[model samples]
Target chain A: ALAAPALAQANPEVRWRFQSSFPRNLDVLFGTAERIASRVAALTDNRFRISVFPAGEIVPGLQVLDAVQAGTIEAGHTASYWYIGKEPGFAFFTCMPFGLNTRQLTAWLRHGGGNQLGDQLFADYSIQAFPAGDTGAQMGGWFRNEIRSQQDVQGLKFRISGLAGQVFQRMGAAPTLIAPADIYPALERGTIDATEFTGPHDDERLGFFRVARFYYAPGWFEPAARLHMMTNKRAYDALPDAYKAAIQVACAEADSEMTSRYDHLNPIALRRLVAAGAQLRFFPREMMQAAWTANEALMADLAGQNPRFRALWDSYRPYRNELFQWFRVSENSYDNFAFPAAAAAAR
Target chain B: ALAAPALAQANPEVRWRFQSSFPRNLDVLFGTAERIASRVAALTDNRFRISVFPAGEIVPGLQVLDAVQAGTIEAGHTASYWYIGKEPGFAFFTCMPFGLNTRQLTAWLRHGGGNQLGDQLFADYSIQAFPAGDTGAQMGGWFRNEIRSQQDVQGLKFRISGLAGQVFQRMGAAPTLIAPADIYPALERGTIDATEFTGPHDDERLGFFRVARFYYAPGWFEPAARLHMMTNKRAYDALPDAYKAAIQVACAEADSEMTSRYDHLNPIALRRLVAAGAQLRFFPREMMQAAWTANEALMADLAGQNPRFRALWDSYRPYRNELFQWFRVSENSYDNFAFPAAAAAAR
Candidate 1:
């Protein structure tokens, strides 16, 4: 421990502030940012320290991109989809309805030309984004009533985000965007009939099951949502290579750590939720099919309307198509057979 | 760059050698060790440097564990299952027939008590183990003939490894463990009728498609094969906290990098294999079912006979069973719906 302070004294100490889009209450999500900071500090022997601020502490949650872009903060931890209003292409970096799952998304981002394309996109906003965390496939929002078919969605108000919200709207549901903090009150007061937020672990913390008994399966809207650490481009460029490497490595660990935490915690939370009277049900096949149809149409329309979206879709669509083929043959086959057998044996 | 040399002068220089249980030609697999070394060097300002030696350079591939444990090499990169003959519990740290996939295995190892359990087991050998890389779900072996049923596997000479070999033998196949370099020659000369290696990228590199043209789907055996970096306990404990942190971070990056690289490259290799006349086929449902049955029986017998195996199995099985339920609801549902649609649209 004495070695750390000595090393810090030998080097000029660097400090940066990180603003997280999530509140501290969602520790698992927000903790990813803290993990990155602490890891960097530890790796650099305390010469580099990053202070993390939760949502509204520095800038409002949704203004993370704005703050980062304007260099008001050195960095921000937030989902890329939150900035879809600035550019629809932003959604691909986070997730899309019926898009790639976590593993697939990571592969695409790191290897399948996504990182470069993402950098090119973010360069427009004077930010450099690094994948920091993932919320493995979210659940379909908690529902106040059983949704048996596409008709059940008619005139229903659902809180969702990104293109999935558009798909829901196209299917006759009134899709609303609400902050994470407001979701519980909205669902309770019937201000929104249902809400989808992250997965079982985060959702349980929000007490969604208490208000809506029917916990749905398969969040088709945002399959695998990725969180990013956005650094001000000028600030990032000025850092020494070692500092840059520290940030990169820390972000990679944070990415894996958050996903693993979710995978471990979500099951425990789901089991507890069930024991406490939450009914787990699959979104009806009819509804799923309808959403898929709407998603395809919406994607086609977006591609037609936005060149940036088209450029990204052209690359991503084929890569995803190829990935799906491989995954279906590999992951899906194994899971489809093994999971059911394991479930049966447990029963 | 001047800062790097100055930093090095301020710290004691450390150099270590890493022995890899993989050939240099198989860069994707072997490169993980090199990646760790370079990343550590970059992070440590060259105060610490690790030289990587490929299989046969320092010790034979299978002798990696022995060399690391005996302190003949400071560190090693190899698959844990390669040492199952030393203790069958070692197989849990790698992969089993129908074991956890990459993400699930990672979750189990990192967050679900696997790291601690692995350390306890490795401590007995005076080695410290860190997961360094993963080959995401491998493909079923390249076959000389289509396996239409369980009968098709009967008496067939199959090149496989780990517990899967035992399972195959129980299923009436003559399972042989052939070195990766010899697999292609064995398949070509009719010495072995089938061979399962890492995945498409490695298989294509080994030119399995040239001889066996019937490339199979879904490697039920060794779904997610993990590569480990093992260090002598004393050597690891003697390192400063900063150096230890550097190794851990480098290993984490390597783990994610290897998996992402495989995911990116496998699809490309599979497409090329198909174009070059490799017929892609799924292992028959009957055969998969038989393998599952054999796997269960083998696990039971091993648990009954070995206490360590039982202890690890007791922790892993329940975790896996629960993981299956959650994945079935989340990942599988999305893939089942999205994949076929994507494939059809592509066609």
Candidate 2:
């Protein structure tokens, strides 16, 4: 109703540094940081600009939580799982073996009780978090020995992470931690029988297929992993509501783009990997059954002793189970019937 | 960069009317329009505002596209398939039977060639489209007489929409078009043997369970139906880049929220419906197989006759196929094993 002159208010310039756990070369991972920075700048007409720095520039890749908490940077972009050692409950925000997939986990965070539960944990560190991106279901691993049955995993030396490592230990595999750069050499030297990384895009870059012949499907351990933008609570709360709103909008786009990009690019990348002699196989049924059994036991055991983990798990598990039922009724049927029929038609 | 005085520019008072095809009663569908309007206004500090109107206040529910195109309204919230009779190519923007689910279709629009193909189709209508929301696969239908086999569908009278209607016709059901308000009465009087609606939340509101005993799974035709924000191209082009960015950001939020809200709300509603005596069932194997066959034939038939529809189908079908294969390898296995095991554990 009023003229522009009457409503005009001064736009304040706000600048902050955002550090990413991922390096610049991994476009889908690190690119989400760049996306948030640019979108925020555009949304606010450059009034609020966030400068993004890759891992190791300011802090080590996995130290993003510490950096954000210590206020070494205004914000940090990293997977929640990287700091699970800091709080075992943090794994719920990324994903777990047999956890909710992309949409399910996202629905949990955004709409279910997961976000509130997660923030309860984040508040302890004086950081505010928002989902910035997701890596869709990844490849399980590249294996030198294909596990045709549950017996094959017994005493197998596997290179994997902690939560999944515990599950593998339940299934009788000795899980060993190896750095990403060391994975290829380890596989070649027979120091690791199998190794898991990100999806085909990053895996192809790592050239794991050259040493490990059998590449498995469904990345059960990480059904779909999410990355977050962790803003120092002090920095985030000081922003004018409009600038804060801009951050919310921009972050939503990143939350969506990161996973959608993988969905788009991974298939094309997987084809290249297959053409280069990567053998795609489903993890044998017996191994998957054993892994599922172990996964449940591990969660129950963690819930029994860690009350904080129990608080998050209480919501995460029930929500996970409910969606599991819903997706099975809808998506599972659609994918099951549609994929084979379409593939058959093409053939 | 210059100081505050130089960069400060007026945010002009801009307003537009947004009409929604869905009624206010379907909160999730109509609520997205309200969300976008508020978000845009907030992002621009009330300088830009979109006034939302429910259907029938300005035009009938399905007239959104025409109103937006003819400039009677600046924008519309409607499913693209609502106007397929105006142009068959419109169906590709919405889901098709056995086509891509929510994430798969969304990825195509955001990253694959889909947005280009869709924009080409929309350009002719003088409308710019953005995905505003999605309904994760609808329930198959409420059946007065259950479809236990392929032959069970023969001569069955089903109140359903066009594309799926054609497939049902191929499967020998006499597809009838009845208004939503008339559907239940028709089924009650045996004028229709079954009726299709949205997922459990909306269906529960319609009280379909009172008349139809069997509610089925996997709405194959609308595996994940997307609703779009269709803006008049002329009105849209006149906006500043900042305003455009605001629309992009707000629509993304709506796109995520609408489906997630359903995912959050549906399971609770479904559990209630079951307690209210709704008999849940899967469409039998034979019926699903026959429906898939009919669906493929119908798509091919449309492709044969309508060159514009053919143009979109070529991109849509292959992309759908690619994602179907990818999802089957990941989500399918996870859901199949997890849903049953979790369900059994709960029991």
Q: Highest lDDT, which number?
A: 1
TM-score of every prediction relative to native: 0.96, 0.96
Standalone chain B TM-score for every prediction: 0.96, 0.95
| CAPRI class of candidate 1 | medium
* Model 2: per-residue Cα lDDT over B32-80, one tens digit each: 9999999998788788889999987798878889999999999999888
**Per-residue lDDT tens digits of candidate 1, residues B9-99?**
3455777889999998898999999999989877876777899999999899989999999999999999999889999999998897877
lDDT of 2 by residue, A1-347 (tens): 44234223435778899999988877778889999998887777777889999988999888999999999999999988877678889899888888888888888998888889988999999988998888887778999988788898998889997489889999999898776768899999999899998888888888899999898987889888888999999999988777889888888888878888888888878889889998889888788878888998999999998999998888888998898787777667766777787888778
Judge candidate 2 at residue B101 and give its lDDT. 84
**Distance from true location, Cα of A281 in model 1, Å:** 1.7
iRMSD (1 decimal) for each model: 3.6, 2.1
DockQ by candidate, in order: 0.55, 0.62
Question: What CAPRI grade goes to candidate 2?
Answer: medium
Cα displacement (Å) at residue A181, model 1: 1.4
The weakest ten consecutive residues by lDDT in model 2 chain A span: A1-10
